[model samples]
Target: MVSFNKFLASVFLAVAYASSSIAAPRPAHSKFATHRARVVGRGLQVEAFHPPSTFQTFGEGIDHPLSKRTESTMEDSAVAFVGSQLKVDFNTIAVRSGFSGEAAKHVFLRQSHDSIPFANAVANVAFNHDDKVVAFGSSFVTPNSIASSSPAIPLEAAIATAEAALGGKFNQHPATLEYFVKQDGSVALTHVMQIQDGEAGIWFEAFVDAHSGELLSVTDFVAKASYQVLPIQKEMLTQGFEVLTDPQDMTASPAGWHNTGTTSATSTSTTAGNNAIAFKGTQSSVTTQSSNGLNFIFTQDPTQAPTVAANVDAARVNAFYLVNSIHDLTYKYGFTEAAFNFQQNNFGKGGAQNDRVTISVQSSAGIDNADFSTPPDGQSGAMRMFLWDFTSPMRDGALENDIVVHENTHGVTNRMTGGGTGRCLQTTEAGGMGEGWSDAMADWTEHNSSAVPDFVLGAYVENKASGIRTHPYSTNATVNPLRYSSIATLNEVHNIGEVWANMLHNVYAALVAAHGWSATARTDPTGPEGNIVFLHLFIDALALQPCNPTFVNARDAWIQADVNRYGGANKCILWNAFASRGLGVNAANFVDSSAVPAGC
Candidate 1:
């Protein structure tokens, strides 16, 4: 009854139906007949992502939402036609919320519809963005975003597991096992499945809770996936080049925390063993002579401080070099003018020298952790890391150079960018970042030595018997050594350390490849033909980062900002340029966790 052409037309009409938001198959562009045949296929719907609490964007400018480009207003079009240039406001709040320094966006659209369909048209029903979705949680089934992507659990296995176990329940995101050993039995993990729609895929993970044996969380990041190209230049968030000074005569005092041209009053270690340190200022020669390591040194001439100040300029320059080595991406605020002093005599009887660096070598003989943390009213600081003259064997892990470096970074970063969010676990994103930054600097300054910089902290343990060096960096939960912070919890600290060290090494290698040899900046901002290859750019990147910000955004911000100032595509090249030998990173792996999120 139907001709061949009529039958083909009917088939084409039947295949042109639109359906689904995120799971629809993509339309294949081809012959008119083939296009119609593929029109009825599915399309994709994208979902949102929930990352960790630790987030800090690079100091470079970030974006806000509600930009003119996203919203086509009379203002946006007039400028485009009049100026002959498409203008888009990059500072909108909506842009900030919608973007995280990424270069694109993703969406779904109708394939065969020639005209704008009515609000209630069949074609309009495809993008079910507001559709209410169910999520299986620990306690009970809860509501989730419209397009939920979770691994499905087989109902058959769920019944058996619940019957055999006690109270097992499901909580929220990351649907997996949540079991409780109580009077009531719980549920356990069964199995999960994938639910597809169009050209996209959504996989959910299901598990029972402990008490109620309910679904817990889902291990899914997206319900739909596609690419959206971002068209705009990034803005600088924090930009202020440093006032370069001689790395030898002056120090780069970031946030007035380190090498502040002033001596710290507290130098004694909290674990200074049974050693009774005597002060030369208060004790007579008879009493001092009898002591083992007592007469805490003091400047004979207090007012003539610059002499002592310039003496330890090595420490200051070392600090900068140290920090740069650790952070291939960072910023520098430059040196402070305050004078270094050690006149208070908090360590032994006398204080640390008013000008020189000193160490107590034992906690019992010096200031404790609590005292060290108590900063003066207006001053934001913790001399945990830089307050070191590391020598001999370390006691337990209490007073180690590495610990000092890690802790000092916290103080510097806190002062530079108001104190961190103070997240819980020291290994959380923020804490890990802080710890890693410090570890990198310290390891860099300590470079040239045979110390194979690693994630392990405080490897040089003190000989419990002789109170000398008995090297060891490992720490266990049950060690009970008052200073023993669990390595598991501290992995965030050390892993970040290795990552940074590795990054510095990589950048250094790249620098060698790019510049024939190590970068030696003869002057501040580079003297004459010497390019300004200072670590200030990188320091600024790290310093500009918002505490607790995500690593990817931070790294991307650094890259974009560098590219904006330098050339394009060659962004990675500048990363090495900003980090050089004078900055202290003699070599690097470029494996920055920021460069690679999965590594983080």
Candidate 2:
């Protein structure tokens, strides 16, 4: 009797456990919890983790195992490697786009559930010459169960909702259903569409919930291209201009600066071309054609203020030249068609086409400031240059090279980071870096030697020697004392950016000290100089970092970029520079630390 009762009790417990397992719902996927979570600006939580090792060597001189098996292409090998890393099937990983560069081949992949895509979840994989995985970064989320694949609301309704939210009209593209990963790590089905309002100076990629028809989020493509004007190395009008003929890099702009299509250059006389179109006040482009090709020179009165009417021709030409120059210069540093650069024709290269930059000189939009509107790939980016009133003779923003370059850098940094989505740098920390990068690029372009000097921005327009920022960028602590801790008290984006730019100034100085400087750094990319390495890492890290990266995440990406490109040759050099700025390995919680990484 005792043995029979014990057996009955055991059977009862087993049945109860089985019943509970069958009745309960499976837990929602929470891989994000396993990663480090930080609440950045705007109460937004981002999860990121740096693996102990970013690079893995399968065997000595051996190709990746996946590549060795069967006749596989580079894309095939990449998808297989990433799928294996994610513990998912390769078929589910979709290859969106990719580009092959001198150093490595980069592939952008997206995770798909059933047939729908994840709007924000993406992974960037790069392979070195040996077909080995050299670098990887991802924000991919695995879904346990999708509430519904079908949308309750129609596409038309979703478009209407997005248009209403943005106060703009749709760009005539079909809305697509995507699995959007919300900030809380929850997945929602959403209809994504693009809306543009040129009059309002706004362009956005808006996402609307599919089931409830609620507006989820919007990524503004229009970044304020604040400050305007164009120059060469000179940041202001005080530095005279040098006339450059056929300035376009043949390798970068194969069709030349004047041609937008495969056909040869045409001969009309406006500042319009494949890379940029310069006009003034609403669609009126200056039409002065010189025998030497689009050359219209004008004289400015040095003693008095200049009028926009008298200098519109020169301003338009300078603006045109500067925009095209930036396009070619950044292209050499890996901002190519495949990287979603601003180009009207891609010439069979990957990425959307028909999106050249539009330059509006003396634009009637506003005064004393400029702006650039960046839509996604295949849409034209617009730049509006305003007149500054700081001087007795108002200054044309279009004549300042630093201001123009600073604005163009907004486009480059926007497209390069987050896999060309143009939405990654929306958070306060990320947005601040955007501004910092613009300032740094401007500072870099003006430097022609290893003897780097403290740089000021908008000095000419502001008519102030101190420039617009609180302090000129300097490596010396006494000169510019901003550090990682400085961001604690900073609430505005530009102020936060001053701290970051100062840190980069230190990093730039350190790199120059370690290697050397290059005089032809602007046009030439094939050098062992510190400036070359700096630009390579600068562009490479943009793709390696996750969307909406913080200061630490960006710093880590730069270090990782060095590891992949230079075999960690500049590890200590980079860490020490960052450490000097209080962003060392031990730094945390916006606090300052002078410690370097253990190995360094």
Candidate 3:
């Protein structure tokens, strides 16, 4: 009787377990607890490990992978971390291959419910060389179970539905298959269609349900352009010119500019029309007025080549070369297809989606100053170097390499920071940083001798010993006393920017002092070992920085970028530079008017 009762009890226990397994969903946290504990053990403090809200301790620097961590092991750990919170089986989170930049040494995971990958990232994790968790960021969310696994409609049908909903004459790109996360926490298969309006400068991402062929969501993919420029032509001529050559010597003739005959224009569909345009091309001449097959000719006097047409031609040719050089230099430092760099050839692979910017070198720009506008990713961007004749300062904004590079860097910063969607540096602090970035690049490009770096902008145009800014940038606080606190009283973007620029100038100086400027600084932008590393770090920091960041946020991103790239070797130098500018470890609570760092 005892044996029979024991057998009955065992049978009852098995039945109860089986029923529970089939009754409801398993808790994701329990499954992920092990991975979470491991991550915590690695010194990465996190309040929660769930998706769409994982907050780690601020100021924690990401380091290089320790020698012990293998690539596969890091990936496995990342997958486990993501999977636990997602409550999904293994292999559900797909790490994007060749994912570098802010996600470098880390895995950028997308919720891969199906074979195809999604457009946006759900989570990312980085492991140090020791295979320890160094950094983790995520926007992941676990979905409630869907009723069906199969789609009722096909991909073609979904594309058609999305197109109809967008309502425009659009030139469609390839459709991307994805799983759309619905508002109700349910998942539906989707086709993400990227389309550009043929009639207007509008680009959008349309998400359509793969099963129902219904439009799931639509969003603008472009942003408005901000206009700013170099002013005046009269007084500019009197200024001691730096790098611009005489117009006669600046012609794009057979003997001039190493003429390559016909070259594809970098302008995008919006700027170049339905078809691509050509520069220095014999096939067609749209902008050039001369029959010499040259857009820029020096028929007029070289010294006094002041005609609007001639000056515009000179500006266009020079601007093209400068911009192209900037592109090539930046590309070498990891600004590739993923970074949304502007390239006409797309570097030979139809290149990931949006990759073009429109430039107006010389136009009836109405203003003396120059400006740039970044419309979304797929759409074309606009940059105009205006022509102005202010007797106070006569200057063709396009003629100055400093001005051109400064303006061009604006495009670079805008595209790099916000995933090429044109949403970056919108806040007061961020905007100031944007201007500072421009100035820093300008100074770096203009630096010829390492003897002493002159912190000046528009020197050729302003013709002043101090340039056009309030003061020449100096590491010495006494010479340029602007600090974060100055932002409060002087809320103007340019004024606030000077303080930021001053900090960067000091940083560059410090890096040069430490790393020794490279002798190849003239031809190569990345030359001067310190400068190259600095530029790379600066560009990488843009990828790491948050949108509309505060001064403190921007500073931290730079510090973290240094940690990621060089394993914090330069952190001390970087800290001193910021500290010198009154932005230090303890500096916080900045008011917009005059925000300064408290101390080192």
lDDT of 3 by residue, 1-600 (tens): 123334334433433443344325743322221111111111222111112224231234333323344545556666876676457766668865323443244454666765655433355555444444545555555668542546676666665554444444334566667775543456667677665552233355666566655554444433221001121111133333223332222111212222222343422211132111222212133344233323233222225534445544555555554655565556556565556666443433322443444556544434456665554455555556665564343566666666767777777777666456444454445566777788777777666555444566766554556766898888777788887666656555577678888888888888888887765543354453787667877787765554345566667767777767677778788887887666777775543222333332
Question: What is the C-alpha local distance difference test score of each model?
Answer: 0.25, 0.73, 0.53
Worst 10 residues of 1 by lDDT: 118-127
Taking all chains together, the TM-score of candidate 2 against the true structure is 0.85
Best by TM-score: 2
**Model 3 regions more than 4 Å off:** 1-98, 101-307, 348-354, 375-378, 392-394, 459-468, 522-528, 591-600
Tens-place lDDT digits, model 2, residues 1-600 = 123334334433433433343234632211211122333222333332211112222211235548666677778887887887878877778887677776667777777777787776777777777777766667677655564888887888878765654567898856678877654445779888888776666576766678866555566676671112234677877787665656778899987777788664443356777788888756655535444544555555545555545477667777887888889989999999999899988898888888889888877667888888776677778888888888777788888888888888888988877666676676667778888998988888888679889999989888899988999999878888899988777766688788888888888899999899998877898898998889888887777666667787788878877876787899999999999999998876588899997887
The C-alpha local distance difference test score for the whole of candidate 3 amounts to 0.53
- Whole-model alpha-carbon lDDT for candidate 2: 0.73
In order, what is each prediction's RMSD in angstroms?
23.1, 10.9, 15.0
Residue 439: error of model 3 in Å? Answer: 1.4
lDDT of 1 by residue, 191-294 (tens): 33212111122222222322222322222211000001010010010121122222221222221222222344432221111111211111121111111222
